[model samples]
Target: MRRLRRLLLLLTCLAIAVPPVAVYSDAVAQERVQRRTVLDLLFGGFGFGRRAQQQPNYQQRQQQHRPQTRSEKPKTKKKVPPAIAVPEPVVVAKLPDARKVLVVGDFIASGIGDGLTEAFTEMPGVAIEARTNGSSGLVRQDYYNWQTELPALIDEIKPAVVVLSLGANDRQMMTIGGSKEKFRSEAWSKEYEQRVAALSSFVLEKKVPLMWVGMPAFQTTSMTADMSAFNTIYRGTVEKTGGTFVDIWDGFVDESGKFVVTGSDINGQQVRLRGSDGVSMTKAGKRKMAFYVEKEIRRILGDAMTIGQPQGGEAVSNLVVTTPTDAADIVRTQPISLTDPALDGGTVLLGGSALDKGSGRSPRDKMIQKGEFAAAPEGRVDDFRLDKRPQPIDPQKATN
Candidate 1:
C-alpha cells in the first residue's frame, strides 16, 4: 500500500506540478517514513556478512557525501570538473597495511557516533575513531573556534579519512569582546568567514582525505540560504585543497526544491530528519547519512578493505555498529540517502532521506530575528543585517 502511494505521488508530481522546480504543498510536510540501511552497522568485529533476517520493527531502505583550498596548497581549479577553486596540499602514499578512519564535527556528528562505529567496525584493515563536540562549527563570526580543535586532532590521530559535519551552532549574531560587533555585517561576516576558510586551508595542508558533509535539504529558505552560502565556501575550499567534494544537495530534495521528509524514512513515521530544527539530524537522519559515507569509502578502497587478501574482496565490512548499546536493538535499517537536488544551485538541508523534504512552517521557519546583529566574530553587524531575508520560495529551477 505504501509503495503504491509513493508511486501515485510520483505520478502526481509529474502531472500536476506547475513546474518541476516550483512545487509547494502543505501535504509535503506530512508523510510516512521507512527504516533503512545500505550496509551493516557493527561496532567492532572480525567478520563481515548481512544477517538476512527480518526484525520485529520493519522499515524501508535509503542514504547520502564534500568540498574546497590554499598552497602551502596546490592550485585546484583547472577550468573544468577536475579544476578546483582553492589550493590544497599534496596527497601522500598511505600505509598499505590498512588505514585509520577519523571523524570530526559538532553535535550532529556526535549524535550519530554509534551508527558510524557499527558501520566500519568489522572491516579487516579498517579502524574507526570518532571525535565530535556539540557546540562547534567552522570557526568564524557566529560560533566557537572549531578550527583550533581540528588541527590538534588531526595531528594526534593522523587519520587517513576524516568525516566532518558541523557549523549549525555557529550561526548567530556576533558581538566583540569589549565592543558590539556582529556577523551580519559584511566586514564582520567576511572576517569570521576568513577564519573558517583558514581552518579549511589548514586541513587541506595535511592532504588527508576529508569528507565535509553539507547541511541537509531544508524546509525553510532563510536557514537554507545560510547553509547554502556555507556550502559554497566549503566546496570551494575543500575541492581546491584536493579533497573530495560530495554535492549532497541533489539526492534528498524534491522536484519542487523543498525537503521531502515524510514519505522518505523507512518506517513511514513522520520525519524528524533532513534538518533537525533546520540545523541538526535526528537518529534516523544521522545513520542514513553515515551509509553514504560508507559507500564512498568502499568505492575508494575496495581491494585494500581486507588486510593481505589480494583478491578476496568479500572480506569487506560495509556496515559496522553505529549504535553502541543497541547492538541487539533489532530495528530496521536503510542507506544514507537524500535527493540532494540543486534547485537553481541553492543550498540543501542535510539528513532527510531521499523521500522526505522536511519542509513546513515550524518554529524554525519564522527566522528568529529578536537578537541583535553585529561586526564582531558574531553575526553582530546590525546596520545591514535585516531582521529576515526571503521566505519560502517557488522552485523555479527544481529538477527531478
Candidate 2:
C-alpha cells in the first residue's frame, strides 16, 4: 500500500513540472525564429542564425542612394611641382707655408698696420710689414713719392697682398705740367686720380691682390668733406681697377654720421679713438681700422687659418701660441725690458714723469720759474735777440 502511494505522488509532481518546461522551450524556439526572420530582412540572408528569405542586392541599393551626374564628366589630374636640385659644397684651398702682407699708407695706415700686426701676431705662417710713411700721402710727391716708389717697395717687401691708404694729404695745391691747380679743381682731380690709379694699378700689375682702404671722418667738417670726395674717387678707381675698396668711414662715426673722438673698441669697450689733435687714432682706433680690412682678406682667402710654423718657414718648437697665466708672468714673458731709456718719453714736452728730486719742485714748476717758452735743443730765437743790431767785424779780422 505504501509503495503504491509514493509512485502516484511522484507521477503527479512530474506532470506539473513537464507542462511548464515544455511551454518555456516552445516560447524560446518561437522567439529565436522571429529574431532570425528579422535579421534576414535587415541584413543579407548569409549572416548569423538561419535564413528566412533572400535579401536585396546591397550594390543595387547603393546605386539607387548615390546621385549620378547627367553624363560622367572627365576628371582633371592635379599637377605636381618638380624637385629642386641642391648645389654642391665649395672646397676652399688651404693656405701655403708662408704668406706676407704689405701695409702701406699715411698716418692712418700706420695705425692700421700696427693694429693688423697685433691681430696677426698669433697667426702663424703670416707676416706683415707696415711700410707707412706718417707724413706722406698721394700729394707732395717730393716728400715721399708712393706712385714712383711703390714698385721698389713691393719688390723689397715681397708681400702676398698690398694694402694702400692715401689721400689724407692730397687736399692742397697739385703741381702739374709746370702749373699749380687748387684742390678739387678739374685739373687737380684729374692729376690726383691719375696718381692714385698709377699707384693702385702697380700693385695689381705685380700679380698681388690690392686692398685700398678708405679714409674715415675727420674732426674738421671741411676736412671730412674733402676726405669723402677723396673716398668717392678712390672707390670709383678701385672698382674700375678690379681692386677691393674697404670703407671704414661708418666705423669711426656716431649715429648722426658725425665724427666721434671716443667710441667703442673692437672688444666693444668705450675708449678714446681719435687723438687730442682729432686727426690721428689711438691704439684701439687703429685696431678697429684694421678690423675692416682683415674681414675682406679672410673673405677672399676662403677661411685661411693660422698654422704652427713661423713666417720664415721655421717650425715652432719652444714657443707656445697662447697661454693663460698671472699678470706678473705676462710682464716677464716679453723680450723687451720695461725700463728701457730709448723708449722713455721723459724730456718730451708734457709727456715725461716729473721728478720731485726732494726739492718739491716739479719739472713743470721749474719750466714756469725759468719762463721757458721754447723747448731745448731747438729753441726759437727771441724777438729781443732779433732786435739786436748786426755786430760789426773788425777790419783786420775781416781781411784775415
Candidate 3:
C-alpha cells in the first residue's frame, strides 16, 4: 500500500509540470511572431540571420503590377483659313488721240471719274479727265464759281463729253443778288435752276455733250428727300437745256426704294456698297454707279465707243489675196445656188434612194404601212403563240 501511494504522487507531479512547460513554449512562439523587424516584414521572413536579403519596397511592388498607360500621342497642328483673293485691275495703254471725257463737280465726281477710268480701261480711244472741288457747289458760288471756271475747262480740255455730278454739299443757304436764300426756297430754286441752265448752256455752246449725274439716296430721310427734290430740279433744267440727266437713285436703294448699305454690285455679287457715313461710296459703289453712266455713254458715242478697234471706222483683214497681173490669167466660175441640187452633184437626199421591191420591208415599215407586227422567234421570251409552252417565272422577280 505504501509503494502504490508513492507511485501515484510521482505521476500527479509529472502531469502538472509537463502542462506548464507546454503553455510557456506556446506563449514564447506567439511573442516571437509579434516582435518582427522591418526587414522581416518586407522580405516576408524572420529577423534571425536566416534568409537575409534585400526586398522590394511597397511603392515598387505596386508599380510592377500597375496597368501601362497609352503611348504619348503626337499633337495635331491647327488648320489655317485661306486668304481672300482680290482681283487686280487690268491697266491698258491709251491712244495718243484718245477722246477726252471731262468730269466736274464735288467729291462724288471724283468717284465717278475713278469708275469711268476703270470702265474705259480696255478702250484705248477713251480718256477721263477729272477736275473736282470737294466742297464746291452751286449754292456756294462765292466759294468756287463753276459758271466762270467751266468755260475755261471746256476750252482747255476740249472734251468730247462733259460729266457733271454735284449738289451733295449744296444744301446750305445761297447768296443771290447779295441776299441770303434758303435751299429749295422760291428764290433759291429759281437761282439754282438758272445756275444749272448756265452750266449746261456752256457745254452745249462748246458742242460738247453733257451728262448730269443726280445724287443718290442718303441714310438720313431729310437729306434723301432734299436730294430727290434736287434731282427733280436737275432733270427739268438739264432736259430743257438739251443735256442728259443720269438717275442713279435706283442703284443705291432696295426694291422698296429704301437706302441700302449692302447691295448687288456691277457683277451681281452681294457687296458692301456704301461707307459707314452713308453719303460716301465704297469701291464697289463707285463701280456700280459708273455702270449706269456707261450705258448712256456707249449709246451716245455709238461706233466711237467700239472696244479693241481704232478711233476711225477701219476694217482689219487677216487674209491677203494676190491678183493676177493680166486679166486673161484670171479664171471665172459660175456661182451655184444653195437650193440647187447640182451644188452637191446628187439628186436624192441621204437615205432617200428607193429600195428593190423583191427585198422584204423592215419591221418598222411593215408596222407603219400594213399595221402588222413581225412574229416573235421560237424560244424567245416574248413568244406567246397558243401552242407554245409556258416559260419558267423568275424567282427574283416573283419575290420583288
Off by over 4 Å in 1: 1-98, 111-114, 139-144, 175-181, 263-279, 299-302, 308-400
Q: Sorted on lDDT, highest at the top, how do the candidates line up?
A: 3, 2, 1
TM-score, per-candidate, Cα-based: 0.47, 0.53, 0.59
Model 1: lDDT to the true structure: 0.60
The lDDT of each candidate is 0.60, 0.77, 0.83
Off by over 4 Å in 3: 1-88, 307-400
* lDDT tens digits, residue span 1-400, model 1: 9999999999988788665576657444223223334332344221222123222112332111012224336667666566566856333333445677777777766744545666555454666678887777654434556566778888888877777776666566555554555545775577565665666667778987677776566667777677677777777766776666555565456677776564354344556555545555666666666766766666555555655434655544443323345757754444333554453442433444454565454443445643433333324454354544445655875542
**Weakest 10 consecutive residues, lDDT, candidate 1?**
60-69
Q: What are the per-model C-alpha RMSD values against the true structure?
A: 41.9, 30.4, 18.3
Residue-by-residue lDDT tens digits, candidate 2, 155-265: 887888888899787778978888889989998999889888888888898899999999999999999999999999999998899898999999899999999999998
lDDT of 3: 0.83
TM-score of 1: 0.47
lDDT of 3 by residue, 1-400 (tens): 9999999999999898885444467535533434567877787756543223213344567878887766635567888889889889767787787888899999888889889988888777778899999899888877899999998998898888999999999998988888898878999999898989888888898888999999999999999999999999999999999999999999999999899999999889999999999989999999988887877776656555554665464442111223577999976554545688677555554446743566467988989998988899987888888788757999999999
Clashes per prediction? 111, 0, 0
